[model samples]
Target: MKFPSLFSPLKVGPYQLQHRVVMAPLTRMRAEKPSLAPRPLNVEYYAQRATPGGLIIAEASPVVNTGFGSPGIPGIYSEQQIAGWRKVVDAVHAKGGIIFLQLWHVGRVSHSSFQPGGALPVAPSAVAISSEFKAMTAEGKVVEYETPRALETSEIPGVIDAYREGAKNALKAGFDGVEIHGANGYLIEQFLQSRSNLRTDQYGGSIENRVRFLMDVTKAVIEVWGANRVGVRLSPYGIANGSGEADPMPLYSHAIKSLDPLGLAYLHFIEPRSSGAGRAEVNHQNVPSAMVLYRPMWSGVLITAGGFTGETADAAIAAGHADAIAFGRIFISNPDLPRRLRRAYPITPYNRATFYGGEQKGYTDYPAHDEMAQA
Candidate 1:
């Protein structure tokens, strides 16, 4: 009753959501080591955040062995991995929550150390990320990104197959749906941006050509999960992971318009002034709002995430800029996020140091607000 619109019911595809505070797909590098699977610890974390009828887009999971860029992040390619994710999906569903796995391939955002045979990371082109950004080695050391090997036209289909395989694995894992990781300078985005994509094939050059790979990947996932159970995340005006289009409007305009007729469950966007770290909330001037700019172009349900508080979230929905708001930084430290926000409870500040690669200390130790009062 507090934030009426934020707490209001909404229909997403076939599922009816109880609230609009969707959990953003966060990359917390804490999967079971060595095997790179979701262990009991990972299951407990997701279960703690599950709310009846609420949606949680689980962390970005590499689809294949070569898709990995960071250590300890879970993979969905192996039998062990599928069994592990099954536990996670079951736990969330037990609490009546809907979960989606984000299929990902890091592309040139990776280093050779993480590659199978010490091969250079693959991308649409062989261009390296500028010195401003660095890649993390499998050993945990950070190094400059190398110029990735361009995929031979024939090899491109194999990469798309990896995403299709991941989609099938998500269904086997018992997930309600799956989201394609087409944003952030990953493989799909490597093919979307002109500077990073310099091929003369059907997947490069014009905007339509640049968008081909995304459509291919989307259609592939739809074949596995169907259009209503699938979603796509894009960053039209973003510069994350050293990816930026000099002119994002024309490229993203075509991409959104192209996807409009697919009838996906929803389209998610990362605001230009935001990232999982939450630092982009400050000192970011002249950054365009992703929802405000593209909401008109998209016809289906639209979800956007950035620096949003309870009041701002409701305002966005009330103003029709976005149908739902995804929270990242604040959600990490607050398990009962929807309830606390609905009641206007004090928010727990997150420790940036422990945001990634930690154990129970910063992972599942955040007590619910009721526990704080009972203490």
Candidate 2:
């Protein structure tokens, strides 16, 4: 039997993973709302994809009500939500899979309908995103993005507190670790980019100020999960969710340098092409691939995500550029992706239409290769 590099076991933080293929955080929006809790449907969905001794970073979950941006999005601040996720954690653990919760807070990519008491969403600055965004309301109605209010200086610590509390809740919910969602134009990314962050305070001007919020949040989360079990996701040139920078390399290089000393679990980078067309075009002129840019800067475990095939992922691991390869869409269609890749099995095509806001049709209906072979 020929062993692929991707099938090799590696240590990520405190856990020793069986393989280097990680299930990236994906939002399916299947959780029940009002409480925004995970249901049996979610339990079934994650359990189906659980690979023994592999790592799975669960979907992005809101940390606060004001940070809610979509319908059926789970939260970690509520007891009911904690109880709901316990089922998921237990289910994954039962299958011998390690799962981490991705903590999220959408800033300007939100509508008032999803906010608390219809208050405007808060961001690093009052700058409204020029790009259009769709947000699901509390009533399940989709609405356009609204102009967000700038977060007051006095309110910054409270925002950090929310992340701390969310991390604590994740621990109570039985998650092995936590991944802070700092990528893709969310609250932390909003602060990182100059186009969206127009504030003149200590949290705004230089790249140091831009990275302050993320650093603060990481520290707070580390207080709960510690540096070993904590991870961070970053999209340096990402223009999604209405945020971008004139030059992302410098900002990201500095950001990576700042984060390198923390001794965190892993630093996950969403490749430029994965961020969307707008960001790709902007970065095409000067930026190199994420691995090329960050490989030397970071010494710890590094994971890269985008469009990757089994061959490409194996080559990446063999080349020593990435410690692990995270798959999003591929994992959606192929539940036993690691086994499939190891044997070079045929992959099932996924339906993009049923990707979100659906029941078990596209969520949990995808069968494993063994099951398909049996049929």
Candidate 3:
């Protein structure tokens, strides 16, 4: 009965959730290398986090070989990778948890080393990410990002095909649904924001043209899995990976209004305050809240993720600002997040050093609340 609204039953799309503490899709970079497939360790990590009726959006997975930016992150383009994800899905389901795979492409955030034949990464335009941001090559060396090749109009369909195929593969992998990773500074955001997308094709020019790629990609994925089983994440005023708009209202309002009629599973937002958490620990004071600003435009379930604790998350749900709250960093340290929150147990602080690219040290080794008490 504690945090009543946060622990209340809710329905998203075709499935029902016992609690509203959704697991935000996090990039841990711990998949099997070379193959870039989810291994047994990854399976164990997900299974440990699975709670009976909880929703876990798995990490961002590239849709194609060229889509890779970091080493060890999983991909959905290969038979081997599909088999790897099948294991993950089966493990989560065995625990009675619902899992969704997030389809992603890093676009210009990639490097030549991560590309095939050392070709430059591709994006909507050839613009390079500013020097303020850094990219990791396949060899794990930190280097400045190079200007990417502007995707030819003819080649655009191939990219969309990758997403559609990824959706089909996710279905084959036994996932309950799929989420389009349109947030952060990835491919979709590269196309949505004018700073990254400078193309004059159908995917650029005016706001309508700029949003064309996102719409086209969403429709393609919907064709594979119905709109009801698909969700889209957007960061209207985010500054992740050097992505920002001169003005975000007109652009995001148009995007939100456009997706409203699709009847999709949900519209997820990354609150502007915590948008840069992927790169560093940041809390921007006086930033506008995404859910509060855009909730009116979305008629379906609205899930927003940011620096939300148990009390704040409950407050958000009680205020009708968001239907559910997704937790990221805290979820990493506490596998039994829902139970801990429900009982108001002490939360273990996360070790940022071991957040990405590590073994059981900071992952599956984290003891559940009961185990800690027994110890």
Candidate 4:
């Protein structure tokens, strides 16, 4: 009997995964405000997708108490928040699935109203990201993305501590592991890019210095959750929301080298195209395979996301380029994505209109093949 490539069992971190397929962390801002807790709808949403060989990393969770960037985005900074996620963890586990929380901080991708005491969004330098999002106000809604305040050299430890606390919260919430969100031009990525992070201090001059914040956060998170239970996501060549890097390879290589000693679960790379035209939407386009080239250099598992299909994903695993493949948008519409892939079933395209800030229209309404047939 020829073993199915995608269905092959693989040991990742401390978990013995049933398959090499992973549900990449995709944001659906359904968590309620004040508590920023995952709703019951989220519980039903993830539980439906849980299956053996399936690894689901929950959406971006704010690490610091100060970061309240997205209106309905969840946070792991408080006890109430941790309790909320516990419910989610329990639901996913009931279906015999493993889950990890993706720890995040949006830095300048935030507005002043979202920060603690209405503080300005913080970044490596005072530079604001060349992107904009809706901001809430008392009187009425307004178009505002004030320039972010720069993190003073002395205050960097607090930011790192926030990630450590988030890791502790994940463990308390009963998560199998935690994935650090260091991609898509967010806070961590903002520091890595030379264009966005222009400072005379040690944190901005050289590639090693720029990657220090990310490395520090990774180390701190691993300390809270054992090395094997921690994973990180990166977008080396990703140019999203007007973020541009002079040279992505050298900075990311140095970052990986710094993380090699940590022995984390896996190093998940976004595999962005050099031209930046195809950023997160993965399809027929192929990355240069540069990030995977350095996989052997690291001590832990390696997972590649962005535009992966059955054949390509199988080939990547077979070739030792990646231990697993993470499917982002695909999992939204196809709850039984793994089964569908194995049986060669037709995929249900996701509705873009209901992707964000909706009740349940496009959130959990998408059905599996069996449900489709019954209907």
For TM-score, the strongest prediction is 3
* Model 1 lDDT per residue over 136-208, tens place: 9999898888999999999988988999999999999999999999888889999999989999999999999
The Cα local distance difference test for each model comes to 0.91, 0.87, 0.93, 0.80
Worst 10 residues of 4 by lDDT: 274-283
Looking at model 2, report the run of 10 residues with the lowest lDDT sum: 277-286
Residue-by-residue lDDT tens digits, candidate 3, 308-371: 9999999999989999999999999999999999999999999888888978899889999999
Q: Answer with 1 or 4, whichever has the higher lDDT.
A: 1
Instruction: Give me the overall lDDT of model 3.
Output: 0.93
Question: How many clashing pairs does model 2 include?
Answer: 0
Off by over 4 Å in 4: 1-4, 131-144, 273-287
> On residues 97-127, what C-alpha lDDT tens digit does candidate 4 reach at each position?
9999999998877777777687788988787
Better of 1 and 4 by TM-score: 1
lDDT per residue (tens digit) for residues 1-375 in model 2: 544489899999989999988999988878886788999999998998888899999999988888877777888889999999999999999999999999999998777887768889999988777646565566768666677899999999999999999999999999999999999889999999998898899999999999999999999999999999999999877667776789998899989999999999999988876775322223244445788678999999999887788999999888888989999888988988888888999988877777777788988989998788799
Q: Kindly give the stretch of ten consecutive residues in candidate 3 with the minimal lDDT sum.
A: 1-10
Ranked candidates (TM-score, high to low): 3, 1, 2, 4
Candidate 1 residue pairs in backbone clash:
none
* TM agreement with the true structure for every prediction: 0.97, 0.95, 0.98, 0.92
Alpha-carbon RMSD to native, per candidate: 1.7, 2.7, 1.4, 2.9
Instruction: Write the number of the candidate with greater TM-score, choosing between 1 and 3.
Output: 3
> What global local distance difference test value does model 2 have?
0.87
Q: Which candidate achieves the best lDDT against the true structure?
A: 3
Off by over 4 Å in 3: 1-4
